[model samples]
Target: MQFVKERQDAPAGFFEVEAAGLRWLAVPGGVPAVQPLDVSPTRIVLPRLTLARPTPEAAEQFGRRLAITHAAGAEYFGQPPAGWTDDGYIGNARLPHPRQPIESWAAFYAKYRLEPYVREAYDAGVFDDSARQLFDRVCGRLADDAPEPPSRLHGDLWSGNVLWTVDGAHLIDPAAHGGHRETDLAMLSLFGLPHLDRVLAAYDEVLPLADGWEGRVGLHQLHPLLVHVVLFGGSYVGRAVGVAARYG
Candidate 1:
């Protein structure tokens, strides 16, 4: 059996871009990604997966596999997945994909990830001057860290996008791109994941994260929160500000 996801009013290449992301994230021996059996302008067809209760064992394996996926690396920050030539989407919002690879993750993130949505949120009345200031502070501070090559990110790794099945956790609905690996891990923690500690521990065992990574969780989380503010204005405004305040 298969499942079909359709959006009659989807933007041009919407489902196609998602299909590309899934294909790009498919690494050898990595955590399984939901296979797109077919894709078109308006819809994507995927294999049906049986949902199961989460388990610590499955979570641990997923962590190790995820580490491998990240290790695949990318040409540079903000580079779109292979086979895609233009921008991507995140929950119906446009996600920028630079044709030219950027070696500096900080520059790419500030320009492509944070700033655009910040402007959107501000225009939508979900962001105030104070919030914008906080984000500006965070952006300035982002360069404090040592640089690392971009990881092949499952850009939206929140728990809801991680489908636990009888086989294990299978990734779905990716905003995949070249980004900081911590962003994915932070996103996993954003909305809570089953056996999250085990997941982190196993991932660390395979590929240790940078020191002070725990402290930067809020930094990586800020983008998604801002996107929330843009897409759903309300408590998300306060939530984004709260996280930005920690780093700013």
Candidate 2:
């Protein structure tokens, strides 16, 4: 790998929060994260990784590593990284993170993740009028969701973020925060990942997922889907509505 520098002009803490998340997530001894060579308010330097084809062996290792990463836990469900104090970002979008303390995971997720972005999507013409009511029903019944401690989430765990190299699977471009571990796994399953079954298998062997986890897949998926509908504006809106209807 060679040294690569990325430069962008933006608000002060954009890259800072990103670097903070990288440092925070990397602390738990598990998955390989991109080595943050150097960081600044407006720029970051990292080892530019060479991509390789994914294999089950590496996928299983990555799954086990990911479990260890999540097991490190976090202070609270909606907690941001130590230095970054705001809701983080996914792609170019602003993600609302929690500053106010909420007791249960369901309350934090409902208040911050589901309702806010759904409102944004609806306001942006992505969702139809009745969509909010369906989400309201889901939010109302979050207590029915399986209980678990906050998992250190790589908030944007889509396939594009997971890179396979000769060394191992490395996670990149994280919107790192404290949220439900199921949310991270849900994002992994959202877009197809190579050798993903191997990954899930290794994950299950390490830290067993909660009961009824499969049943709640769509529920955990609601946040990212809602984000995409807001960002992309098409069939995703319909899919988001469909997921909300399940809980409704």
Candidate 3:
């Protein structure tokens, strides 16, 4: 059988963290996770999945299982998996997953997740003074926010990472950690996941989301957008600014 292998020549413990994420997610049977066959500093090998078209049923199944997986819970906001230090990666971007002294999910996100990326973009000149100010407002208000318990998140759940096949939706290439469950759902909506409505519908049936969760999509999306701003270039800066503007 053919296998899929990911090779990365950067970071201190890149592949290891991903492999731990896959195992952590798979333990909850969240969705069909890529089989972690063999892992090494430079490579991770997994059994390749056959590609197929997506269906509502597949999407719904994915959603339901995703909720179950999330219900497994996490140690704390921004907590890393056991054995791995508080460090992670999102599409090659270094993510230092530090649990903030604050308690609220919004506070944790604002401090550890959003603020870091925004500051990075600012230092790199991707975010000008005006844009940085707007984003800072979002962070300030985060202390006033309340959210559900920290969930086992597929930290970067963008469309490219969710694969649809005959089996259902299988998640791959994750930056998994403890985070707000809505963050994953928000990411599923970001860049458009196929049958996303169906996915959310099924997920809601399994574990209902808080009211006005839809409105918070932009808020949860800020981190990834800023990540892109730092990782890529100017194109994502405007997108990040746009999302921050809405929250501000």
Candidate 4:
């Protein structure tokens, strides 16, 4: 494999690995193997693979494959390694290392994941008292149910994180962990990207999303938006507030 591009923004000591084990439903068997060799704290080497902007059909297939990957499931929530970050960002809400069993998704997300960030931001003055109260209400509603199944997630998935290669699509730089699959999909849509419609269509064809899945997108995105707000500052605060308002 040869070095192609370098990423400056990734957390320290991060690198992509070969796409294996997890079977992507859209691609039938799996994605073509590629090596993600670490070059430095913020760089990795990827073998050159020709890629073009995806067409609608291709995007849909990508979505379907993602759903299948999620369908593969996890033994328990929070199984993947915690995300690495500089400056103690603590992106995943300081959840218990090596995730333990939890009765419901709501409880897990509430205690181990969402609440911590809310509290941290509140304590730091990132959010006003009213915003904090609204967040609390949203968490309360989340406690009513667990996700249908625990999924092996690419915790920090986004449009740029997806690499469309000649052989197949690739997911890189994952904060890979077990959590709600929607979190991954939610991130994809967070920053508008091409081929999204196709991806969503394919995903729904395979997994058939629940009736109110659209409503939950805001909730799923809350974590990342909050992270961005905390890391980058007030620019993301409005977006975070918008998501919170939807849930409130």
Task: Report the C-alpha lDDT of model 1 over 88-188, residue by residue, as the tens digit.
Answer: 99998899988897758888888899999998887776777888888888778778385777899999999999999988999999998999999999999
User: Candidate order by TM-score, highest to lowest?
Assistant: 1, 3, 2, 4
Q: What is the TM-score of each candidate against the true structure?
A: 0.97, 0.94, 0.95, 0.78
**Pairs of residues at least 3 apart in sequence or in different chains that clash in candidate 4:** 26-65, 59-198, 59-199, 60-198, 60-199, 105-146
Candidate of highest lDDT? 1
With a 3 Å backbone cut-off (N, CA, C), the pairs that clash in candidate 2 are 87-97
lDDT of each: 0.90, 0.84, 0.84, 0.65
Pairs that clash in candidate 1: none
Clashes of each: 0, 1, 0, 6
Q: For this target, which candidate reaches the highest TM-score against the unseen true structure?
A: 1
> Candidate 2, which segments miss by more than 4 Å at Cα?
1-9
After TM-score superposition, the amount by which residue 46's alpha carbon in candidate 1 deviates from its true location, in angstroms, is 0.4
Evaluated at residue 156, the lDDT of candidate 4 is 67
- Two-way TM-score contest, 2 vs 3, winner: 3
Report the C-alpha lDDT of model 2 over 1-248, residue by residue, as the tens digit: 65544556656567777777888888566887786777886677778888888988999999999999999889998889777887678776777787866698999889888998888987877777798778888999888357888888888899999989987899888888998898888899999899888999999999998888998889889989988888897888889888889888
lDDT winner between candidates 2 and 4: 2
- lDDT of model number 4: 0.65
Q: Output the lDDT of residue 111, model 4.
A: 71
Cα deviation of 42, candidate 3, in Å: 0.8
What is the TM-score of candidate 3?
0.95
